[model samples]
Target: MFDWPLLRGPVPSVVVILGAVSCIYLLAARGRRGWWSRTVPIVVMIGVIVSVIADKVIDHVLYSASVPVEVLAWIGFGAGAIALGVARAWRATWWQRGVVVVTVLVVVAMAANSVNRYYGEFPTFRAALGLPAAGEVAFKSVSAVVEQPQLPVSGRALDQDWTPTVRPPAKGVVTQVYIPGKVSRFTVTRRAYIYLPPAYSDPRRPLLPVLVLLHGIPGSPSDWLTAGGLAATMDRFAAAHRGLAPVVVMPDATGSLLGDPMCMDSRLGNSASYLAVDVPMWIRRHLQVDDDSRRWAIAGLSYGGTCAWQLALRRPATYPTFIDLSGEVEPSLATRAQTIRVAFNGNAAAYTRATPLHMLAAAPHPSVAGIIGLGRADTTFGPQQRLVYAACRHAGIDVRLLVLPGAHTWQVWSVGLRRSLPWLAYRLGITAP
Candidate 1:
């Protein structure tokens, strides 16, 4: 089960509580004034507080559980009812009424957007608010799952050359296994999913490369299976290549930031250690993979993008290649230094040191290869990629940057991943047959 308390932190809870209290006080005091003058502000405030809190709570719960779209929609209906009631009861002039109506609509729209962020389908009210349709909801939903803290470290290595337990069957076979980890125990076991490639089935193919595929914030391992269609994608590629596919591993990247792990080791959790060490160690012991640093690739979208860079830079001996799609590089220490304090355990210097852009400047890793893809329309794409590209160039590291057309949507990341695969394979020496 997902943790609801994780979503509504003290910050949001305090804000909601204060809003509610203020609304009640204003409404009660307004009774002394004219009905129209006092009732309007009082009812509007009450409506705003109720609608916002109810919607936020529902969104928090729905996102945590990966609940269905219909369930979120039902919650939206209840929230909308409260909003409508307040709007109707607000005794105000035409302009005031318009303002209240607009505010209510905006709140409803935000709630709908939150639901779409988790449920993989936009509610009807989203279209009414001029929001994007629900084509990429699955990716968003899966991202949420991968970011959840249900999975944590297992203190195992993922570089074993071959293990019967995690290997694929010879010819036509598929198996599923669950191994619990130390950090979150049962929660981690239930959420972690590992996939061994076809090469694992053949004894001739020893030391197969591994690709630690990460999902963005609010995403999970299931997103690659459902939204990314990675299994089918790998199957087709492998078939065409005469049976060569990289072992793909996906893990939840959320736990600290936004109830989603920023993929960093923080006060919220030990996600960084879980991904960089535990996941790889587990795969090594259970699967047939090349344990060497040169054969490993780490990549992710959004916050996962940030994680990919952080992991590769920090553990260059473990991951030599990194793919970042529309990820934000942590800002320089001089600016937003406090962010590191908040996100990385109150250690600004450590945060700056761990940042890929900064680390590459001090000590260059020759074996490491990097690819950064950014959407032209994404607000952070160009600037973020520029920082990464500049750092790689300064370090004389091999890197590629591609700017494509699109927004911060999964469609862009999916297309980017597909396009980058051949290059990545070539760099890793993963040829057909």
Candidate 2:
């Protein structure tokens, strides 16, 4: 049951790879004769049983993740059919290898339905063969390719009947950037991504809003661009609205590619400061956007979603609207003691003081709006999200809790973004409130 969702995204790749391997095995098995025919069936049956046991052991004792067995089960089922076909071909004088091909194709065709349901149509099919996808744009560095836009103290205003400096906008241009860490002074570290909608260069461009999109703990800024389909989604919105979209700054909050950062200014790094101060400061200095807090939103998923809530409450004046897509209730480790030990160097009081739930309790309730979007099947985070939503309502803050269809996977996140982006646009004044 747990493995059913995993099959949705990975089955197509499995089919392609499994089908290829089956073709090769079909040729090899065709040359076999008498005694070997019977042994092949016995061997395949044994192999299937052994593999299942091994997978269970690895899932329970070795790996940390709850490894799904559905995909592997499909592979075994296909392999078993091929093995039976091989046995039959060798037994008869007229060795027809078509049986193996038919069985493999049938199994694969059934699995193909689940593709793009989770990973969101990866850029290339070659990736199914375990090859690096070509045309992979690492990060779009806008500052290096184009000159930085400098806004006056007032800000960039709308142009009457203004046309875009760069016209015929398709999807937004994603450029990798090195946003200066002038305030936090954290490493200029990993590259961040900036998305310029078609309307950015438009002469009639209104003061565009800004959304700081954050990824999960064990993830990169590129996760949003690649797996989350940020480019495609934004492009659709931009194409509809004549290139008018938020100046999307996908800043790297987690300094390391795989570290949690917890959105805290701790021994790990000044990640909270980086997001709240450095990234925003750099965006204002370098990009043309509405400088108003009302026009700014900080949004994230998983770890980044937790960061969004933390940043919103801590710097309520800077970002009043935060979209938490499947975020935790507070900054967490395996245990409270462990969190205190690691983050604040054994200072339990500091850990409690810095937690988002604690901070939200102490802070004054300002007129703010929040979106708590969680996947309906995601049991771990959904309950906590409800608590946070309730807290927001009790505090006189406006909040909407949406339980979308999907588990904790890209399928859910894609929906989360699709739902949140319009609201984000509406709040930031890109669309009418």
- Using TM-score as the measure, the top candidate is 2
Please report, in order, the local distance difference test score of every candidate based on alpha carbons: 0.58, 0.69
TM-score of 1: 0.60
Candidate 2 per-residue C-alpha lDDT over 155-203 given as tens digits, one digit per residue, 9 for 90 to 100: 2223222345566467667777776667776665677877777776555
Backbone clashes under 3 angstroms, per model: 32, 9
TM of each candidate vs. truth: 0.60, 0.72
Best by lDDT: 2
lDDT of 1 by residue, 312-345 (tens): 8778888889998878766222235545766666
Model 2, residue 385: displacement in angstroms?
A: 1.3
Candidate 2 achieves a global lDDT of 0.69
